[model samples]
Target: MVSAARTATETRTTTRTEARRAPDIVAGVADADKLTDEIAATSVDPRLWTGAFATNVWGGRFAIDGVLGEGAQGTTFQGTDLKTGGRVAVKVFDVGRAKDWKALQLFDREADTLKSVDHPGIPKLLDVIVDQETGARALVRTLVPGESLAAEVKSRGPLSEAALWSVIVDVTDVLGALHGRSSPIVHRDLKPANLIRRPDGKVCLVDFGGVGRMRESAGSTVVGTFGYMAPEQLYGAQTPATDMYAFGATLLTLATAKEPEELPRQGLSIDVEAAAAKLSPQLRALLTKLTAPDPSGRPADAKALLAELHAIADAKDRPAAEPSWPEPMVDSPFAARGTDGDFLVGIVGVVFGVLGVVGAIIVGQLLIPLVLTIIAATADGAQKERILAARARVVEAAKVAQRSFERSAQHGARKLESASERERDRAEHRRRRKRELKRHWKDEERRLKQLAKDAKRSARRDGRFWV
Candidate 1:
């Protein structure tokens, strides 16, 4: 009876243990189902969530932090490169969307172009990603730290001449580098909005979406901003000069404190000179040449335009003879009353030798009278003749230097004239080409109209016979 009682107690304990384990198994299964449902909710529609992903870390690599800007092509996100822990600008294009096909092509083209070219003024392409879920493409580029030139100009009004010159020089250098490439690249959209001014006072060119190689065939669609685009570019013809035209239009806007499109237009051309009347004559002339109705009237290349710009700067910096010196010995190391006056004169002459005629004249005006007075007051006849001869030599050297400068200036002017002549010839050729194109298009239109009329007439005759 005791053995039966002990067996009954063990069976009761086993039943309690089994009853406790059944609910635990059921709860575990319920938890798993809940997890599966949550996962399904997250993964069901990538299109809805893909853009949201840009708010967090993307592709497990880029940490999308903020929206930098958006364009017609794609939205640019300011992000962190998780691999390198550096700042990056990620341009995301939803290729699954039908409207973004052209944008995808442009984004791909920009990436390819950036990969091929290297310039400090250009953003470096770092990485490219294709999301499997959404089929979206992302182009990662190094974040160029700066404000857009357009923004700067808008906020600050027109830039100072010095600031403007600096911007022009920086952009021209970049353009020169691009145009000098083996297969010359043209930034079809060379507008103020596409340029960035760094804190270090350097300007960088960005947005290669409209970049094109000179040798490539023209695209079917018209590209670039209307006011900034050259006449030929509107008809799918882009050349280095096209960029020059855009550059001119950009400058005009900056100088005039107005949008290129807002400025008065003469037929297809912007009246740049009238709009930018406040700018210097040289700059005004440059704007005219740059915004010429004909592509041939613009600078042949960036290098050519750069040369002209440098010449303008040189002219501005060229010293002129003043009636009086403004503190002649302000920064001079030589003492005015030194016993070794000849030594001081020699030093002045040495300084002038390097400064061309302007420096020589200034030094002469300051020292020659002083030197002559000293020689008259202290030196013997022989020393006086020697000092006078030295003065004469210095004057002669100054005249020679002046002649050389004139010759150099003349040479530069002649080169500019030659460029203008060449440009005129090209303009004539382009005009002929444009005329031919217009004629061909008109003829084709007429033919199409006639064919349509004939078809309508045939249909009418057939209807009458049926009646």
Candidate 2:
């Protein structure tokens, strides 16, 4: 009986120890008490939750790998979808520790906006997860694979003018789509950090935390980064023009590798002239209009802005006009110079003529005056004829040269057009091939997904699957 009692006591002791020593195989969700403790610890330490240990959420559908970034709304994590084994970005908002109610509202709005839109330059929403226990909400999205523009600029220095323009063009094109919707969406915060540059030079916009619809009622507090926000955005007035301002600010940052506010400013306006001095005048002017203190000074809409940008691009593509010959080179010598020099020459000629005529009359007989007159007339006529012939020859030579240049230019233009057409055809063929390959890969992906589903079902039927 003593031995039996001792065994029971030992068993109880073992059970208590096991309960105290909870497994650490998973992070933040190992045990309720541990998760709470971790949450508190992370809040106090300000260190990222690396997720070195697996964090299985939503019944192991997603396993967060590590923290990708921290933002005003929440923390974003690099994670993997267990079902498809595809990478995803997981944004988690801890409601319990939210700074204010506005954060929650912004989170909801972002989720809604993401769900409503579908574009290649934007992240696609995959799933939404809410933890009842910890009061944590998460958004799962397809990972936009690339480094942020901020990071790229930091490592590589300021982008070249062409590259910067291309970046802005890509961004504006994406914005055009966003703003073209019935209830246009404004990306309230547009900056280098929120823009991702892909390997193929495509830009992907992320962090819809400050996204707002046009005509939406304004909140009391503004939602945007200070350096990238428009003046009106400070008063919680957001529109497509507000985004234009942010884009302008972003361009400034990319061009100068400095914040908009850090650059020289003229009153409330950013001195884009000083900030982007190396950029084209058109780009500078566009920046000035976009970052104008008043909304009316900016482009009316994204479409108008796009048209202006395209116009600038077309102007760039066109060949420059041939430099015209200077007026002095083509005009008569007397016409080029002022009449002062001609007048002086005429005075000297008159004096010489009088001396010549007096000498001829004094040294010759009575017929001398008449002979001199005839000789002078003949000489003047020959001089006039020679001058006329020379002028005519020069004019004709210029015409011939102009005609040759015109012919050459025409032939060169024809060659360039043919080459451009051939290149366009090649590009189209490449696009077609790429589309076929994409379709084939998509089919393969679907088949693999089906196979995975079947395997999971088989495992469940065999009693080998565990949730």
What lDDT tens digits, residue by residue, belong to model 1 across residues 63-137? 654557667666676767777777888777767653646666777789888776656788867767776756777
Cα RMSD of all models vs. native, in order, equals 25.7, 15.4
User: Lowest summed lDDT over 10 consecutive residues: which window, candidate 2?
Assistant: 45-54
Off by over 4 Å in 2: 1-41, 44-54, 216-218, 322-467
- Across 1-467, the per-residue lDDT of candidate 2 in tens digits comes to 99999999999865654343221324333355644344333332222221221134443577654557677787676767777777889887777788888889889888887776756688867777775545677788789888999998899899888888788778887788789998889989999999999889899899999888774345577889988998888777888988989998998899999988899999999998888898888889989998998988998668879878756754554335312212232334333333234334444444554444444334332344444455556666777566555545545554555455455445545544544454444345445656876996799689768866865574565332221
lDDT of 2: 0.70
* CA shift of 394, model 2, Å: 31
Clashing pairs in 1: none
Provide the global lDDT of candidate 1 against the true structure.
0.68
Taking all chains together, each candidate's TM-score versus the true structure is 0.57, 0.60
**Clashes in model 2: which pairs?**
none
Worst lDDT window (10 residues) for model 1? Answer: 21-30
Per-residue lDDT of 293 in model 2:
87
Q: In candidate 1, which residue ranges exceed 4 Å CA deviation?
A: 1-55, 100-102, 215-218, 317-467
